[model samples]
Target: MKNSSAADSVVLGPRPQYPIESVDNALRILLLLGERSELRLTEVAEYLGVASSTAHRLLAMLHYRGFIRQDRRSKAYVPGTALTGVAFSILQQFDVRQTLRPFLEELRDETGETVHVATLDGTTVRFIDAIESPRAVRVASRLGRSMPANCTSTGKAMLASLSTERLHQLYPEEELPGLTEHSIRSRAALEREIAGIRRRGYATSSEESEEGVSSVSVAFPAEHSALRLSFNTAMPVSRVKRADIKRIAELMRSTVDRAAALLH
Candidate 1:
């Protein structure tokens, strides 16, 4: 008679069977590395319920394939350069709007104001995602809109990350367009504002992008190739008092840092 345990192992329904055990194990190791910064061979073996020798072989194969690297002194395995390259490629293919929607929504709920994610496209910053405030009186959504790099807080945040030579290349004209009287109107003034933004590690716009909207933004570090991104929260000038700018900016920076960590 067939063993009852063997009978239980066989599925009677439409459940798919994972036939490649080795590939499944390797994929699990990759996921484990992605979630953790480093792991020792013993820890890996214990976690995977495998013998030390088997764990070593798996790790050796992974190291050979450039998915992980062993530290010279600690012997702990960390993500390798190849893994980073693959991660960057995946991020390039991923939709920014979908990735940032939850974060932007949280920010909007936290501040009761509009939140946006934007990226630099040549001399302009384009809004790729936005979460509108629930308040009756709130800033209008700027989704699918583009603004001059020197006019908006999100734009300025991205602009602050660029080299001076790159900035000059983008804005060769002496005078720049202003959305309002508050917007930076000259290259020298815009450069000065960018210097301040770099020093502060965030950017702010006071009725510069629009007549009454004020915003604070922070730029994400370029950990992924060709991805220059920033996020911002905007509120009406009446709602954001002069004294509240610093506090709001700090909060925005904290949120952006969290988002950056998740993406990284």
Candidate 2:
């Protein structure tokens, strides 16, 4: 994921000579939440390298301060109003979402399927924007959600653009975390898939990230663009067929080409 907890987020400056442990730990949790939309107490503990009791205390303080709020059922800590307000302000400073939203809307209109514009964050892919399909029985929007890159077409599309050395740095281990039985489970398997995506110039997923959700994704071209995002169209499993893929891939590729032109 985009976790410093996992990916060592750039710290920007030398370590402080007189660091306060509690304050540092609290900031680390916030950083992790920036990469992940939700976190659990156990995950917080492991990420911070702290005891369960200590992690709980930090989470309680943040929850009290309204930086985070626990889900009613899941009990996972999610961004609260205060944190979201800050994030919204930061997003305004970077106009990627504003720039690509129209392409997402047009793709949804053309395909009558859910469309998303997502960017890779370390080993994760975060859905930054989305447009829902008009159909009553369509895949739902995954806006603001993050998942393993190898498991999603959006993530794979972006990952395939990375150099081989970069790919190794991201997946140093042979074993990979799987969301479902169909997810790519080994680094070898993932590498093969990445190679295929590079040749195909697009990517596809069939219930790998989530059951009943299959998608086609084309990474926005890098030409004249620094933004690394993908154009994705998702549909229910029953609605997807082999014949549907070539058509969807063509639309995804053309749409991304047009969106990429706007970056200049």
Candidate 3:
């Protein structure tokens, strides 16, 4: 009779019967690689409770399939281009509208104004989602519309989050185009406004993008990778008084913080 070692006697509790053992082991390796930046064969073998030779064979298969690559210097496994494509594809399937609409709706309801989620597009800000105010006299919904990033509250908020070098790259010229007289004209002027936004933790546009609309916006923290986004509440200048901007800005900040938490 052969004597069993502690390793051989150790039992893993119940697992699904339908999964193929080899495929399951390979997937487990893939998941482990996803969590870690790099993995050595010895580490993989220890992690999976398998022989070094078995782990090497699994890694070789993954490398051949383009899901993993070996570092020439370290001989450790890292995610490959194929894995990046898989991750991007999975991210593309995430519905931003579905995830953010409830927050926009809640903001609109609370503020009694139009709420917008805008993302930067070149020198412009595109409105990706909106919830219109219930009041008949509210600012018109700008969903599907694009406006200059230098002029809109949401745009300025996102712009303020960018680095100075990036800002210069985006606006090489001295002057930026304006939709209204209120719109920022010079890069220097825009920079100053952005400085204020950074200090205040939010931005405001007083008829800058449109004749009658005024808005207050706050940029989402830099953690969101899918888009550089901001949340704004727009109202007719008649409805949103000067004193109201402070209250609305605070509300926008709180709502954006909650939305950012949900995203993570």
CA lDDT of every candidate: 0.79, 0.83, 0.82
- Of the candidates shown, which would achieve the greatest lDDT relative to the real structure? 2
> What TM-score, over all chains together, does every model reach?
0.63, 0.66, 0.65
Residue pairs clashing in model 2 are: none
User: What is the Cα-based TM-score of model 3?
Assistant: 0.65
Candidate 2, superposed: residue stretches over 4 Å from native: 1-93
Alpha-carbon error at 243 in model 1, in Å? 3.4
lDDT of 2 by residue, 1-264 (tens): 222354256488899999999998888888777656578999888877888999999999999988898876557787776776566445536887898888888888889999988876668787888899999999989988989999999988998887776576667779998899999989899889999999999999999999999999999765445346788999999999898898989988888888788876
Ranking by lDDT: 2, 3, 1
> What is the alpha-carbon lDDT of model 1 when measured against the actual structure?
0.79
Cα displacement (Å) at residue 262, model 3: 2.0
Where does candidate 1 clash, by residue pair?
none
Off by over 4 Å in 1: 1-93
* Model 3 error, position 228 (Å): 0.5
